[model samples]
Target chain A: MNSVLTIDSAIVDAIVAHARRDHPDEACGVVAGAIGSDLPTRHIAMDNAARSMTFYEFDSMEHLRVWREMDDSDEEPVVIYHSHTATEAYPSRTDVSFAGEPGAHYLLVSTREPDSEEIRSFRIVDGVVTEEKVNIVDATVDA
Target chain B: MAIEVRVPTILRSYTGGSKIVEGAGDTLSGLLDDLDAKHSGLKGRLITPEGGLHRFVNIYVNDEDVRFLGALDAKLNDGDSITILPAVAGGALGFAAAAAFFGR
Candidate 1:
């Protein structure tokens, strides 16, 4: 599978905003896209049920509902994103171990620094985390 | 009649390379017990001898982490999805470091 993630600029901004807003606490969410297209279009910022600074867990019912909706719409989570309040934009050991989607890109945004935010994407499969290319494009250029 | 448990690639060895398997139980722990019967060595990877979920292992019931619910006792229903994965962290590497690892 291609390891690169192509996302909308607006979505990136929204994710960053959410991360900043949740500062000190980790923010988690998902971006859904047309099945097999790999083009992320829908952004769904999820509730970190854990509400812990060091960990994040999506609300169970909400996750089920969102996943089912995506299934009905013939879409899938293209990107699974979360923020690191004081750490770097990287999947922690727990993150790597919890990554269940071999097809989804795991995006991490570090809000540790007030002036500069670090964002990165990766593909975590079989316990290995591999960084991927992130290309941001305008959302209005679609045919 | 059975809940679908999605297996991660790393743990597929115990499942005979199957990505999805059926386990019968009303709670997360029960299901794992059922899975243990069929796929030996799998439960050990997920549950510690202390009966708690392995710290590095995260089990999600319908996309929610079981740890937040009831851990091993989380309730389950038929058709509910369970996903098991191993946690690992990455992303702090600079472009050069990532390139060295991913060779991109």
Candidate 2:
């Protein structure tokens, strides 16, 4: 499996925007892609069930519907992402423990600063998280 | 009734290396009991001695975290998907090297 995460610049913008919009509260979402493609195309911003600045949880019913739709479309969760409001972009112990996707990239965006946003990606397998490089490209390049 | 349970890689050893297992129970706790009966030592890893879920373990039914739903007593329905994962805590320190979890 590739260790680097390649995504479109537009998606990155959207994620950052969401994180910024939800300042003080963490934002969570997923990027669905075709099976075996490793390309994240669909950006699904999820509600932070916890709605806390320190934590995030997806609404159960929403998660079920979205997952079922992905299954029906033969798509998989290519990227599972969330934001850190005041802290840096890093997976917490809770995040690592909750990671169920060994093949999907776990992306973290930090909106700690007013003008700067930091984004990073990782692969969590068997509770072991490894940082990976994120390559942002123009959407047309991937299309 | 049969329920589909998704097991994480670290805990798959107790499930005979199977990522998915069959379980039957009306509630989340009952389902866990059923799983433990089939795969010994599995319950201890998920629940603590106090009868509550482990701090590092997370259980989700049908993609929703049981903690928000009803925790150990979360009701289970036939064909529900239950997923178990270990909580990795790290975002406390700054962003650098944040992905590398400190304590197991």
In model 2, what lDDT does residue A1 have? 80
In model 1, the runs with Cα more than 4 Å from the true position are A140-143, B1-21, B25-30, B39-42, B54-104
lDDT of 2 at A78: 89
Would you list the C-alpha lDDT of every candidate in the order shown? 0.79, 0.80
The list of candidate 2 runs beyond 4 A from truth reads A140-143, B1-20, B54-104
TM-score, every prediction: 0.70, 0.74
lDDT of 2 by residue, A23-110 (tens): 8888888899998999999999988776777777676567767766887898988888888888878777767766767778999999
Position B41, candidate 1: lDDT: 94
Specify the poorest-scoring 10-residue window by lDDT in model 2 chain B.
B95-104
lDDT of 1 by residue, B1-104 (tens): 59999786668889999979999999998998899999999999888787777755568888687877798889999899897764422233333443233221
Give the alpha carbon lDDT tens digit for every residue of A1-143 in model 1. 88688888899999999999987888899999999999888889998776767767676567667766887899988889999888888787667656777789999999999998898999988879899999988873231
The numbered model that scores best in lDDT is 2
Model 2 error, position B9 (Å): 6.5
